[model samples]
Target: MFYFFFESRGNQTDPVVIWLTGGPGCGSELALFYENGPFHITSNLSLSLNDFGWDKVSNIIFVDQPTGTGFSYSSDDRDIRSDEEGVSNDLYSFLQAFFKEHPQFVKNDFFITGESYAGHYIPALASRIHQANQKNEGIHINMKGFAIGNGLTNPAIQYKAYPDYALNAKLIQQADYDMLQQKVSFCEQATKPCGNQSNAKDSCDKAYNVCGEIFNDILAIAGDINYYDIRKQCEGLMCYDFSNVETFLNQDPVKKALGVGDIEYVSCSTTVYQAMSADWMRNLADGIPSLLDLGIKVLVYAGEYDLICNWLGNWRWVDELVWSGQKQYAAAKNGSFMVDGKDFGLQKGFGPLSFLKVYNAGHLVPMDQPKPSLEMISRWTKGLPL
Candidate 1:
């Protein structure tokens, strides 16, 4: 189960947004003191208030998912192994237990949102929440919808789009792009069948390895470019500068302040990573069409400049999803995403779903462009268009 909680400073009536960061291993703590949380770390390594935190418009929950992420730990190693089933099931249990303890929030409008691998977590977990709501099961959560940020939902379309993304970004020469282009069809073929839930683990794993190589080598030419953002030098997780966060978290005083006991905090857990990757190639896009059909609003927004889970690939998959309004959704033109009355991104919506291509952000939108990211989330969560 997940652990810890970070409540936002806002009106009690605000909708609750459960935020999950996508490392498959990275804990929510990354999102807590950084990203969309109420506070951010300063240059001197002290914390400062973020006026644009998502907490301004909604309450947020950032939990260490699986059994061993962040402060979440278990005596049994088996508890650490997290596949899609464990993530979705444990999150469902967590919500039930969470709402039980905090009964006042049970009926409040709830939204699930996250970035990166959370593309997998949000959809799978949202499906469970919706199903439970249908059965009028325990808690009867006021489940509204979910949003994913630069997530990995569909591999076939995404994998095929890599060469074009790199080429269009002008990262590679024409000859190199032409050479890489030949490999896409086969790679996409490998990814296409692997998304099926019925596919065997070995089969899916092999496909991910085969097709994922397309984007994996994007930086091979540049040699030092950040995979998260081709716009910057590779600077490690959190863009290297936030190494202080790891330092601060490891301190005795900070640990005690957060009620984290004797356990040492790691930004990411290898055990959780391995477990989540077992079926990493599984087609998460399978759940989207149905989830949308249930009247659950889905927001898939990607930062325009990201190399890993880039906006082009995210848009491709959304356009490819089959649903009741597929044709209409496909034909819809993008509307300017405004922040502070200024255009900041582009959004296209149909059938309770929308896709936004945020400008100049990367894999972590909040970290790169915090103000715009905050406005984007606040507006969208309130049923505002983009």
Candidate 2:
């Protein structure tokens, strides 16, 4: 694993926060360079630093995980297909090596944060850390908490949050909402009868496909184009056309300043995906429950506009959690919120120890709504009232 560290100006002994990138395959640089970090693309597509980067308040480390993301790669030709356990083990090992190298940080409070598929990654890693803490006496791992943005935590809830989010976004008409609701209800009621016999996997795939079709139809009517093209257009709004791809591909100066190497594949690389898939499945089945039982704080956030891991799905998943004090902190309305203090209206809430549904955001919440995203994260890490 390769890490990108942002030192705190306050003190070297200050708490250290580790940021994980989603995808089971994604690298942290994508978040560092493209999202809520110090760098943003100008309207002319030039790189500019965001003044509100989290680095201003605390030391942050972004990790390229599972040994195949970013600059990290594996020489073994073994199929990197992993579940949840593999992820936890690898991360546990990485943490050991990481702290050993930066021994000063061994006692600093640490937080694990991420988005998207990290809904799974963060919990699994937390579980491993907790287990290690128990196994080793007097050698404590000061794991404070974890946070996720627009996460994919529970499969069932995630699949179900579709029509509600669509209706709120005004992407689907009232009639379409009624019809889809009926279909969804029927699917839920007759889950067994509709069986292709692949268990929940087949059912979820079917449900998601139906959900995707509904959203696709809505986008088709609104944009007069295919959903893929609309997504491409949206991404184009933020992407910079670097004049010298080679120079930009070199290790980012910001990352270098933070003490990381120039790594290949900053974003969507095949190798990253292979390692992620392997790690996610392994940990989910065995690793995650261990951490939750240890009382490690886990916060999962979702962006309402993100069709990839829609708020509907996240809401559904969260609802399935058996936590006693879980409550809905924010309500879903139009693709925006009315906040009393903040200029950028944020739909804020606190319940069951997780934050969900930032408004006006797509799959990439930080890219679409950086200010609120950062604020949510800051408040969460500090254990402040949201």
Candidate 3:
């Protein structure tokens, strides 16, 4: 694993947060430079301080993982992970080694966080650490909780919400929504088998293929709008471009400073993404109830404008979660999410679980609303209300 660690600019006692970007294969550098990292790339490729960087409130680590993603690579093909077990195990092993080398940060409260597909990664990794700690495994990590922003955690439930989200967002008409219901029903039926432990990889892959049509249908109807944020149109193949990130990292001076030398930076590995296709429809939410039972905090926040991995899906899964606090959480009314005395969103939380619907933002909340996102992290890590 290749990671960039930035210590807290506030207090040394601040929590340590490990951030993972989605794509199942996207490098964490996307978030590091474009979202919530300590710096942003300038037009001239110079580094400029991100005023609302998470490191201002806590120590943050950006990791490129699962091998062959970003700056990390492995000679063995077996190192590529297709499922949460393999993914979580690799991260768990990294944490043990990391804590051993830097014992000082081991005692600090640790947090797992990320966006997009990290919805799957964060919970699985948190569950891995929780189980290991209960069993008295190597290196008892002082884990606090986890947070996900616009992530696709429970694909079955999330996939089903596609048509409803489209309808509610005014992206589709009543007639189009009524038409999409068939696709939604098909996705739901196909995805059910994926939740079964005895299911074959072929079954999961089939489910992924079937359920993907729901989003495909939406995109076909919605035109060129960015799936990450419906409010924006894609510039090319991507809604937002970070070509400068590639250009900057490939520079000899930058490579030498980072000590990566001549190793090519693989921005997004198609090999790893294709390998993990079968794992896409599996419900990662199955492991969260156990972690919640152990009193591990969870925060699921979403940007309202995101079509894929929309707020509606995340809210549905979190609300329908079969946990001890499910009733209280369901009964709880949303409160204003204030930043500097202005309401930026709505928050619903009870006990160890929280859900936020950020206003006027998209899939990448920090990039869309930096100050509010930073305040969100500050409040979340401190166990304070939003």
Candidate 4:
């Protein structure tokens, strides 16, 4: 069984949302404390309430996935699914059991959400859920929509936007900027094989090595800066010291409370990352149009200041999506995203598709601007304007 940390207001009228974190291995335990989950990690290394938690708007399940991540583990190494398809199948089964165990939530409207690598996970899982919903493949879920923050949905095209994003953000000089433009061609060529699932695993491995060099080039120029947030410099050993999270979860009391015995805890799993390496560069954007066509809502939000999966690339891919309202969606005017009478960000969306450019935020938008993030989810989940 997967380790799922469930939180609810117990309001039967509200929707249920399953939240996943990226890394293909970054367990949702990180999301539970670090992002939109109810708790905060205090200086005392204990849990505190987050006023802007996503649970306020819906019943949320924070899952530690991929069979070997966080508290969720299996003795069989092959039990883990390295690709997006296996991950989705595992989650689908987990959800089936989850609803069976708690039948009260079965009828509630449901949604799936995640960030970073989940860009790929969300679309893949959504497709599976969509298929299940249509074919009666499993217990019917009132699947509503999906939201991704600073996700890597379309790495192939998103990679092309990085050089321009750096230039526009003033992170690179004209000489360096031109160099990035020159590298874009090589990066795209190298990324081709990995862009499709039909290619050999070796080709995908090659794409990661070849295309990743472009990012490495940018990192060389912008030394000691946070790739997740360009406005900030790298913090401590791991860019941001989540050591406390690792430390906190490892406490005996916490482990006992979580019901996972004797298993080691980590914020992310390196083994899972290596297993998922080949699927990393494959384009998830290809799945979005079909998802939208299925009438499943797609909300892609990005932090304006992030460098890794920057806003430019996110917006570009959303606009590139082919659908019934292609022209109107592209021409839709961006409006201020207001919170407490203050303009927090700008949003432009139409029909079931929407994209928000979160101002003054980074890769983890909720961690950066919690109130606005909450408002964004609450709005989209309720069919409110983007």
Per-candidate TM equals 0.95, 0.74, 0.98, 0.97
Range of the 10 consecutive residues with the lowest summed lDDT in candidate 2 = 277-286
In model 3, the runs with Cα more than 4 Å from the true position are 196-199
Question: Where in model 4 is the C-alpha error above 4 Å?
Answer: none
State model 2's lDDT. 0.60
lDDT of each: 0.81, 0.60, 0.89, 0.86
Clashing pairs in 1: 195-283
The TM-score of predicted model 3 comes to: 0.98
lDDT ranking, best first: 3, 4, 1, 2
Alpha carbon lDDT of residue 240, candidate 3?
Answer: 79
Summarize candidate 3's per-residue lDDT along 1-386 as a digit string, tens digits. Answer: 88899999998889999999989898989899998999999999999999999999998889898777898888899999988888999999988988887788888999999998898888889989988998999999888899999998899999989989998888888999888888888888888778834346988998999999989988888888998999889775557787888898889998999898688775678988998888888888888887887788899999999998999999999999999999999999989999888999999999889999999999999999999999999999999987
Where model 1 places Cα greater than 4 Å from the true spot, the runs are 1-8, 237-239
Model 4 RMSD in angstroms: 1.3
Candidate 1: residue 107 Cα off by (Å): 1.2
User: How many angstroms is residue 55 displaced in model 3 relative to the true structure, after the best TM-score fit?
Assistant: 0.5
Error of 2 at 170 (Å): 2.5
The number of the candidate with the highest TM-score is 3
What is candidate 4's lDDT per residue for 107-188, written digit by digit as tens? 8888999899899888888888888988987789898889989999888888889888988888888899887776788878
For model 1, residues 238-262, the per-residue Cα lDDT tens digits are 5545566678888899888877778
| Cα deviation of 272, candidate 3, in Å | 1.3
